[model samples]
Target chain A: MKNIYSTLPVIGILLLTLVSSALPANKPPEKGGVLPVINLPIPKNPTEKVYLGLSGDGFFKIPQIKAKVVIIEIYSMYCPYCQKDAPGVNELYTFIEKNPDLKNKIKLIGIGAGNTPFEVEVYKKTYQVPFPLFPDKDFTIHKACAEVRTPYFIVVKINDDGTHQIVHAQLGDYPGADPFLELVLKASGLK
Target chain B: MQKIRLANLIMVAGMLSVFVTVSMAFAISDAYKGNIYQVGTIKPVDSKLVVKKGNQAPDFSLPSVSGDKVTLSQFRGKKNVALSFVPAAWTPICSDQWPGYNIIKDTFDQNDTILLGITVDNIPTLFAWINQMGKLWFPVLSDFWPHGAVAKKYGVLRSNGVSERALFVIDKKGAIRYIDVHDINKRPPLEDLVGALEKLGK
Candidate 1:
C-alpha cells in the first residue's frame, strides 16, 4: 500500500513533465499594443541618416513612415510558410499600390528575421518583392517584436508624435490578398 | 491480503491511465505540426579549422535528394564546388539557411560554382524539408547511413550527432580554397561566400 502511494506521485510528476514539454516555447505578441522600438538597418540603404529620439543612429528607424498606416511583416527567408506566402504578400502590396488614396496613406516593409543583407536581397530578387525589405540578421528586431513566427503581420497606426500603435497583430499568413488588405484598411480606419 | 493485492492493482491501473493521457497529449501537440520545432536562443559553436587552404580536397560520394548518387570528384576539373553542411533539418536555423541559398543560384552561376548541401538527416527527412521550401536549384546530399561521414572527414560534425553550419569552397583543381565553420546558430553572410568564390576566379 505504501509503495503504491509513493509510486502514484511519481507517475503524476512524470505526466506533468511530459505535458509541459509539448507546449509552445514562443508566444505571439498581443494585438492592440504599442509597437516595440527595434533598430534595423535601412533597407537597401543602411548608410542613410535616420533620427531616433535624440540619437543620430544610421540604422533603419521603425514606425518612421510618413503615412498614416504602416504594415510590417516579420519573416525569414528560410521559413517555408513565408516562402509560400510571398506571392500573397506581393499581391497585397499591389492592391495598396493601385489604390491612389491608399497608396499615399499606407506603406509596407518586410523585416527578414535572422536574414543577412545578402539573404534579404536574394529573397527580394527571387520574389521580385517591390516594397523595401531589411535584414534582421541577429534577430534583434524579431526579439523586440516578441519572437513571433514567420509570416507574422503587424498593422500599425502611426501617431502624430512619430510613435505607433499596433492595430492588429496576426501570427500566421493572412487568408488572401483581398481579405488581408481589407483587414489592414479597416484597422487603420481607411475603410 | 487478497483485498490489499486488488487495491495495489487498482493503483497500478490508475498510474497507467495518467501515463497514457500524457503520451496522447504529446502525440497531438504542435511538435509534430510540420517541421517547426521550438528551439531556444541561438547557441554559438566554436569550430576548429581542420582543413587548411590550398590543400587537396577530400573526395566522397553521397546520395542526393533526386535519387542519384553524387561524387565530389565528378565536378573536379570542370566546376568549382561549395559544400554547405548544416546542423540538422526541421530546426529553425538549418531550415532557413538552405532556402536562402535557393535564391542565390545566380551568385554561384556567376562564378561557375555549384553548391552541394549536406546534412546528416536521411533522404526522406531531407526530401520533405526541402520540398516544403519549393524546388531547390542545387543538389542536396544526404550524409546518413555512415552518419555524418562527410562532416566527420571535414571535422565539422558536432558532438551532438549533427554537423556544424560550415561552408567549404573548393576550386576547379580540387583544392580547398576557403573554409568557414560558422557559428552554428547564425547564418553566414552571403557576401563572404560570394567573395570567396570570386577569389577562386583570380
Candidate 2:
C-alpha cells in the first residue's frame, strides 16, 4: 500500500509534464498592450525605412505616410489561414485606396514572419497584393510585436507628434473588407 | 519478502507510466509537426553534392497529390523536368516556394518543362496544405513511404528526415542540365530558375 502511494506521485508528475509540453507556444498579444517600436524594412521598396510605435492610442509612422493610421498584418507565406485570407486582404486594400479621405490617412502593410525577401515577393505577386509587404526573415520584427498568430491585424493610431499606439488587435479574418475598414476608421478615432 | 516484491511491482509500474507518458509526448509532437514553425535566420547548408550536370537523372515512381503514381522516367522523352525538393510541407520556406511557382505556370509551359514538387510529407498532409493555396498547376509528389527514398537517390535528403531545398533541371533527353541545392531555409530566386530554363534553349 505504501509502495502504491509513492509511485502515484511519480505517475502524476509524468502526466503533468506531458500535458504542459504539448501546448502551443504562440498566442495573441493582449488587446491593450503597447505596440513595441521596431525597425521594419519596406517590402516593395527596400531602400525606405519604417518604424512601428504608439501614439495617444493612435498614429503609426510608415514610409510615404509620415502620420497616418496603420493596419499592420503579421502574416506568414506558409500559413494556410493567411493564404485563405489573401483575397479579403486585397479587398481591404482596394477599399482603402478608393476612399478619398481614408486613402492618404491610412496605410496597410504585412510583416511576413520568418519569410525571406524572395518568399515575401512570391506571396505579394501570387495574391496580387497591392499594399507594402515586408519580410521579417529573422522573426525580429515578429518577436518585437509580441509573437501574434498568423493573419493577425493590429490597428494603430498615429499621433501628431509622430508617435503611435495600437488601438485594436485581432486574430483570424474579418467578415469582409467593409467591416474591417470601418473597424480601422473607428480605431483611428476618425469615425 | 512480500513487501519487497510489492515494492518491485510498484517500481515497474512507475517506470511503465513514465515510458507511456514520454511516448505520448512524442506522438503528440509528431502529429502536430506540421504546425511547428521555426523562426529566425537559418544559415545556408554546404550540401555534399552527389549528382552532377549531364548525368542521367535517376528515375523513380512516387505517389502524387493527384492520387496517381508519378514516374520520373515517364516524362523522360516527352518534356524537360524541374524536380523541386522542399524540406517539408507547412514550414515557413517550403510552403511559399510551391505557391510562388504556381504563378509562373506560363514559364514552365513555354520552356516545355514540367515542374514536379517533391516533399517528405505524406499525401494527406500535402493535400490539406496545397488545398489552402488553391489549385496548383503542377503535381506534388510525396516521398513519405520509404521516408524520402527518391530524395535519397538524388542525394538531396538531409540527415534530419527531410529533403534539402534543391532544384534539378533535366533536359528532355533525361540528362541533368542544372542542379541548385539552395540553402534549406532560403527560397531560390524565381529568376534563377527562369534564367536556367532560358539557357536550356527551349
Real interface contacts reproduced by model 1, as a fraction: 0.19
Could you tell me which 10 consecutive residues in candidate 2 chain B have the lowest summed lDDT? Answer: B23-32
Cα RMSD over interface residues, candidate 2: 9.7
Query: Mind giving the per-residue lDDT tens digits that candidate 2 earns over A87-140?
Result: 998899888779888766777788887667777777888788887787776665
Against the reference, the lDDT scores of all candidates come to 0.75, 0.72
Alpha-carbon error at A97 in model 1, in Å?
2.3
Q: Which sections of candidate 2 miss by over 4 Å?
A: A1-30, A40-64, A76-80, A114-123, B1-34, B37-48, B89-92, B185-191
lDDT of 1 by residue, B1-202 (tens): 6655555566566665544432221111111245566454444564455678888888999999999999999998999999999888877667667776777788899899999999999999998888777789999999997998888888887777788899999999999999988877566877898899988889
Each model's interface RMSD (Å)? 9.9, 9.7
For model 1 chain B, give the 10-residue run with minimal summed lDDT: B23-32
Candidate 1 lDDT tens digits, A11-81: 65565555444333344555677766667654433322211122343564567766788788888776667
Against the true structure, whose DockQ is highest? 1
Cα distance off (Å), candidate 1, residue A138: 2.2
What DockQ do the predictions score, one after another?
Answer: 0.16, 0.14
Clashing pairs in 1: A40-A60, A78-B96
- Scored against the true structure, residue B188 in model 1 reaches a CA lDDT of 80
